[model samples]
Target chain A: MLKNVHFGPSVLPFLLVLPQIIVTLVFFIWPASQALYQSVLLEDAFGLKTEFVWFRNFEELLSDPLYWDSFKITIVFSFLVAFLSMSFALALAIFSDRVIKGSGAYRTLLIWPYAVAPVTAGALWVFMFNPTLGIVSYALSALGYEWNHQLNGGEAMALVVMASAWKQVAYNFLFFLAGLQSISKSLIEAAAIDGAGPMRRTIDIILPLLSPTTFFLLVINIVYAFFETFGVIHVVTAGGPAGATNILVYKVFSDGFVGLDLGGSAAQSVILMIIVISLTVVQFKYVEKRVAY
Target chain B: MIENRPLLTIFSHIMLILGVVVIAFPIWIMFVAASHPEIRMTQVPLPMLPGGQFFENLDIALNRGMSGMDGNGVGYMMLNSLAMAMMIAVGKIAISLLSAFAIVYFRFPFRMFFFWMIFVTLMLPVEVRILPTYEVVANLGMLDSYWGLSIPLIASATATFMFRQVFLTIPDEMLEAARIDGAGPMRFFWDILIPMSRTNIAALFVILFIYGWNQYLWPLLITSEPEMFTVVMGIKQMLEAAEQAPQWNVIMMTALLAMLPPVCVVIFMQSLFVKGLTETEK
Candidate 1:
């Protein structure tokens, strides 16, 4: 990607790149490789003895029902988050795009949640849904429904999902709005002229053109739910109600830091690395295809 | 104005208003909670409207801090967060600008290798390798320090890529003209390149500031000391403490304090934020 007629050869470039390279090596690459290495080695609880067990940690994880449960929970949680936030954002984006006036005001109102931290979002929702004094739960009780996330697994999952999804809506809305703005308006005009109603035009033309953005947002949202939502889960449920809300990332933290199962946690970390690497590859592939288009 | 569809427009406006209401509902509740006295918050059917204790609660949260936990006031934690966010945003922008400039302007050996190295950091998010990274940080004796909180998170691939893209779009004639005037590479960078990318840098700084401010888990992991706790992570401590005392008013006030800066940034610098977001994602 370098330009022609660039600067002559010198040691300046190496000096310039050194800080980033050092940080990457020490923080990112080293720890990642340590995870890989530790996944194959088992340490005793006292940190006194170590046994080199190649692949046993992974094998053990594969057979563990709890691990599988966390895996399943993560998938369900991420998809729910991605689906809920993306659909809501897409709806808002479509509406905002259609309106000719005050679109910027609508955008300003909608997008500030992107700046709200997930943990703060979690606190807000958790307060609103607290079983005893929360106004929302108080209303729910009036309607003959019990809303105790602390005791119910399903409620815990739902609470985390809502908190996580709420914070992400702004991001998805921004991208969807950008995508909508980028689409050719003449196509919508032509469709309207052909007697296609607004709904028909959106379904036939707008959604198809927005697929690339939709796909990109889907991946990004899944990634967000996967990793960035640790704070939400931590602050809201703490993976409680029988670990029903414990996703994979949380499990890695709990197992390693809390449970002291270093090998198992490292194994989980390695698996997560694989997942992220694959997701990044998919995003790049899609980006390349979009560029070609 | 493809069609004069009054009914559709009315419906669209209604739905948008509804969307805004739902999105803003929790925030409204948060504000209402923050405004009331502590005793009122614990009573049934929590006040749906604001009380006159808003500034009082802010004073308590900022000065006295939440009881039954580390007594670090909300004001102090906000300072920690501000410092961390500033360090991360500035550190990332600085390093990324240098690396991007080097890669774009110089034909150096192992340049592609370094680029890929930086790119790989994108995949290894701190969440995945939590224990090992913490171990490394602890081993380096960086725990509870600002450097520990900011340095690990500063190696950003997206920023580098964004700057690279920005530099590539600049015309080559500027560099040539500068060279003809006997300007050194660093001089050209200072006088021309950085000035040209000023808007991009500002936009990126807005996004990164939010990013650094909003960090939760890493700060929670490293900053064991009360003084080092960021407002975002400190909310967790207050939440945990609430399990015992239920200080809803003060905790809500802290949450508001934590969110205020970044929310203000996004709202005030809306266009720059949008630009940085879209460009970085690319």
Candidate 2:
């Protein structure tokens, strides 16, 4: 989309674009190519020699039970995060939209959590649920149940999900509120003139109309859960309590950086790249075809 | 206004209040934890109310290191984070502005190719290619440096695409007016485009600052030296140490310190923050 009446091209345009191009190539393009290249090659433990083993890394990963289990964990984690955060945000947005007083204050109070780093969010959750000293755990014990994330995988998963979802609520709330605000007042008035209750109108009109925002947020949230929650997992569980919370992104880091499995980690990276590319495609399709982007 | 719905209004207030409480709960707890003495913080059913040890803990957390790690004070880490965030925010905006200007103004060979190259970067986040990227950073001899912390992350496509979007919306009349005055391309960009995109640039500055400050994994990967540890990454080390010593007050203080600047930025520049976030991300 260039301007029709524009200056002639020369060294100026190249100079303008050179910095971004250079950074992108050195950091983004080269590393991605390296990941792709290393995914197929098997190198010695000491880094002396390399062998090109076509698809063995992929085959081994597919066959490995832990990898498969983490795949399931990623799906379950992303699902819970998306569902919980979206529903919370939608509910809040609905109520926020219905309010006549103190709405801006409520919005401000709710949206500031978006500023909290995920790791800090995780740490906050960890403190609140710290089995011995945590208030929540103490409250749970008083309620005739025990809470200890360090030894229980289910509890660990719940802790992380809460932390991740908590951090996301602010973001989702902003979008959902914007989506709610953008709906025409006439539509709701028309629904009300027909004597439809608020719930009915929301369920019938608002929900359906908000689906595009919903779908867009669903993809955005899932992508967030898949990639951005590394810090959360790292800070909260380290994929521990017996590898219960090991999502794919964390696995890529631990495998490549910690476990020293070059081929395997690179393969995981390749797989992750594929996932991201597909998600980006989905997002672009929505923006191009459905959403008002 | 359509209908009074007094009952619904009350329910709405209740829901909004509950939403605010739930959203603020964890942060409140973190603040209270940061205030109490370490011994009190370790007590069961930790104090729901804040204690007077806040300034004391803040003093220790700022000057001395946390419970476990040594030599990387919260003060230094915060400074490092500020530097990194400022660099990343400025670098991304500067480069993106220049490129967006070029893309929208001039028709050149490989223009589409360059646009595609920037677009493709959106799909390749640092998480996917951590190892090779780390290797690249190491080879560049930038590891544990501020440049190392900020530069590779600057290679992202979001800022470029955002500036491109911003530039496209600037009316052609502005450029035409400037050109009829015999202004050069750079002259027009500096005089007209810069002022026109000032708000967008400021909003983006806020978002990118937060993004750069909240960065965890990249810095965790590249910076092995304790002195180079950022405040956010340093929290992990402190937490690990807490498992043994349980310095909840100090650790939580660091956590609060780590998050304060970004949170303050959001609260202060709210409309701009929301504009930047919704426009760029969605």
Candidate 3:
């Protein structure tokens, strides 16, 4: 992919790349390798003693019920977030496509939430669903629901899921809108002439064509739910009420940073790194296929 | 659209309205909460309409922040966030541009090696290696500084890749003509390439600014000093403090202020934000 005409090797290129290499080495590589190294070492809670232990940390982690619980919670949370955000966004994108008039207004109105921080989103939702003063909780009580996420684990998980999904809906909406708009109008027109209605055309013609975008967003949303929803859980639940809302990332933080379980946390970190690498590999493989398509 | 039916049109409007309402409801609640007094906010069936205490709540949050310990004003936190965001956005664009330029224009040893080095970083997000990265930053004595907040996060693979993609598509004739005129590499970059990639840079800046401003985990780890706290992360502290002192109005005001700048950028520079997002992710 090099240009046919290029400059000869010189100190300029090295100097240009020096900053990135140094930062990447120091911050990214060194630290990542440190996590790998720490995964195999057994260290006490205090900074006094340490010993090299092979896969015992990983073995202990595999046996730990809480870690397994966190794993299960993360899967459930990620799917809920991906499903809720994608379906809601897809519905909105479909409907917005139907109404040509004021579509820009609707898009502008809908897309600003992408700018909201996950923590800020959590704060807003928690405020709304506050057990004592939150308006949504107040409304729920009138409906005989008695919403108290503070003490209830299921409700806490739901609140974090809602906040996480809420911020992501904007991102998914933008992509879905772009995907829908890219479809040829002639295809839909053809379907209409063949007596298929709007719903039928959407189900039969549009959804099939939109599969690539859907697949891409599925990967993106899962990645978002897995890694990026850390702040949402931190603010809303703090992995509390018996760690019900504790996704893997939050578990990494709490177990490492809060619990000060160095080896266990490092093992979690290593596991997370593995998860990210696999996700990246899968995403790139599919993306190459998408590029060819 | 294929010949819209009247009933379908009505249904579309209804669905779209409902969607917008659900999306905007929490934000509207935050705004309405920010306007009313603290006492009004504690009651059930909260007011749907805005009250007239917006300025008063703003005054409290800006001038005398919720946690009233030193250096906790929302205004100061907002300034901290602005500086961090600007540094990250501008710093990432600058370095990514230089590295991309170097990789594309000059044939050098270890070029592909360095490229892969940058690529591998895409897998090592700050979250995954939180403790070790914290140790590195702590060892470097960068905690509580703007460098700690921005620099480690600024070296990005996606931006570099975006710029490489931008540079690869550039017509080679432009570089040939510049070289024939005896233009130096820096001159060619500053004079020609920068202007050519202006929109890409601006779009990247908008997205990175939002990304930087919205950072919670990294900033939370690095900045322990109240003066160093960013507005986005400061909201959590405020929320925690509110459990003791019921300053609901003040906290909501802080939340609104925290979300205002980036939301304004997205709403106003909608096209650029979208461009940066799609291209950078590529």
Error of 3 at B250 (Å): 0.8
Candidate 3 residues B1-282, lDDT tens each?
788599998899899999999999999999999999878877667888999999988988888776554544789889999999999999999999999999999999999999999999899999899999999999999999999999999889999999999999999998999999999899999999899999999999999999999999999998888789999887899888777776778888999999999999999999999999899878
Strongest candidate by TM-score: 1
What TM-score does prediction 3 earn?
Answer: 0.98
lDDT of 2 by residue, B1-282 (tens): 578889999988988888888889888999999899878976777899999999999998999876556744689889999999999999999999999899989999999999999989999999999999999999999999999999898865777888788778888888889989999999999999899889999999999999999999999999998889899987898888877788989989999999899999999999999999987874
Candidate 3's residue-wise lDDT over A144-255, tens digit each?
9999898999999899999999999999999999989999999999999999999999999999989989999999999999999988988898998898988999999988
What's the CA error at residue B256 for candidate 3, in Å? 0.1
Model 2 docking category? high
Off by over 4 Å in 3: B67-72
Using TM-score as the yardstick, the better of models 1 and 3 is 1
Which pairs clash in the backbone of model 3? none
Clashing pairs for model 1 are none
**Local distance difference test, per candidate?**
0.94, 0.91, 0.92
Q: Kindly give the stretch of ten consecutive residues in candidate 3 chain B with the minimal lDDT sum.
A: B64-73
Highest lDDT model number: 1
Poorly placed runs, candidate 1 (over 4 Å) = none
What is the C-alpha lDDT profile of model 1 across B142-251, one tens digit per residue? Answer: 99999999999999999999999999999999899999999998998899999999999999999999999999989988988888989987788888888889999999
Share of native interface contacts recovered by each model: 0.86, 0.83, 0.82
Question: Order of candidates by lDDT, top first?
Answer: 1, 3, 2
DockQ of each: 0.89, 0.84, 0.84
User: How far in Å is the alpha carbon of B98 misplaced in model 1?
Assistant: 0.2
